[model samples]
Target chain A: MNSELPFLVELIVSAFILTGAGFAVIGALGLARMPDFYMRVHLPTAGTTLGVGCTLIASVIYFSFSLQTLSLHEFLISMFLFITAPVSSHMMAKVALHTGVRYVSHTQGRPWPSRTQRPSRDNSQILTEWPKRP
Target chain B: MLRIAVIIAMLMFTVSVLLNLYRMVRGPDLADRILTLDSLYVNAIAMIILLGIFLGSTLFFEAAMLIAMMGFVGTVAVCKYLLRGNIIE
Candidate 1:
């Protein structure tokens, strides 16, 4: 029933936190240094997903050990982040394309479809219709 | 040992946030700015969670959760406006 954490637990938590911070820094570096918006957009996934994941795991372990109860709630944040990060990134990329953000000169890909075909719909029309308020 | 780790991690995260802020301000394009804003919030949440661990307080979790939700909503709304030129139409 001792409240003090053992050495192993502290080490594990420290490892998680350090790893999380490292990933976050790497992600931010990519965002700042990348040559194009599309490349920059892909970088923060490192922070939003794995960076948060490691820190949350650290938090959960630290709390559960301190409180002597199985504290699993930090997972909720990571879960929500996991669900939202990709979607938010996708939306940002779409906006970038819709607004005609320029790619780096050497970026290899087919030219984006002209905005005339449809603004909301991509070539595949993944989201053909806007959601209506019920 | 843990204290040192927390200090180092927090320093790194602060630098990360600053990098995101630089991109947001220096953006040559609107979408690039928006993307940087989105990444900024996410990095902020990581910083908050790290703070929680450093301070040994669970209260910050609620703040982190709220940031996550609001950040997603804000990104979506802005992206929507950029895409369609109107949020509600």
Candidate 2:
């Protein structure tokens, strides 16, 4: 068909789409398979960032070449996803910590304050940032 | 060539969504379920974008953008609710 895309363009677009979908699938698999909440939290970043990034690029190429006009608007969604994914993951991880979700026993180093040293509700006693041990 | 590729991509995305669903349903904790939900929405976005490419429609872009915004807000609100009993507080 005369209207079809050239072979090289088709190949490139296909490659991009496949790569994106592959990353997304792996990310989802990681989410399902990770042993702990923290590990699960780290998994979906692959999907939200590189996965979406590659797919959006493919869409840009398809629409731009097929329509014979530039279509940069898709970047808006990609950028939004990039910004939001980390922030959401961070929030989720923080909540996980606050809730005392189980962690791997062999995890190295202490990050958050130990559960026994709960911070007081009094505003005057609370530090601006990291809590200090009494 | 492109058509076949789009089909395969769609299948892969569907599998990912199903995996997310499995995690959401089998969660050992509330936070784990919510995190799966987060991944679910992102996977959904990928699916919609793939569909748009297959159908050659620009209309899907708006839907994808809206989903991204709403999904982020929903996740943040839920996480806040988990951290603090009240979302507004």
Q: Which candidate has the top score in DockQ?
A: 2
Instruction: At residue A47, give the lDDT of candidate 2.
Output: 61
Compose the digit string of candidate 1's lDDT tens values, residues A41-134.
8899755468889989999999999888998879999999999998988998788776677788887674476563364555455555667678
**What TM-score does candidate 2 reach?**
0.88
The sequence of per-residue lDDT tens digits that candidate 2 reaches over residues A1-134 is 11387888888989999999899889889888888887788888766468889999999998888888999988999999988888998998788887777878666554576442366545454456667789
Instruction: Tally clashes: model 2.
Output: 0
Instruction: Provide the fnat value for model 1, as a fraction from 0 to 1.
Output: 0.81
Where's the lowest-lDDT run of ten residues in candidate 2 chain A? A114-123
Q: In model 1, which runs have C-alpha deviations exceeding 4 angstroms?
A: A1-3, A116-134
TM-score of each candidate structure, all chains considered together: 0.88, 0.88
RMSD of each: 5.7, 4.5
TM-score of chain B of each: 0.94, 0.96
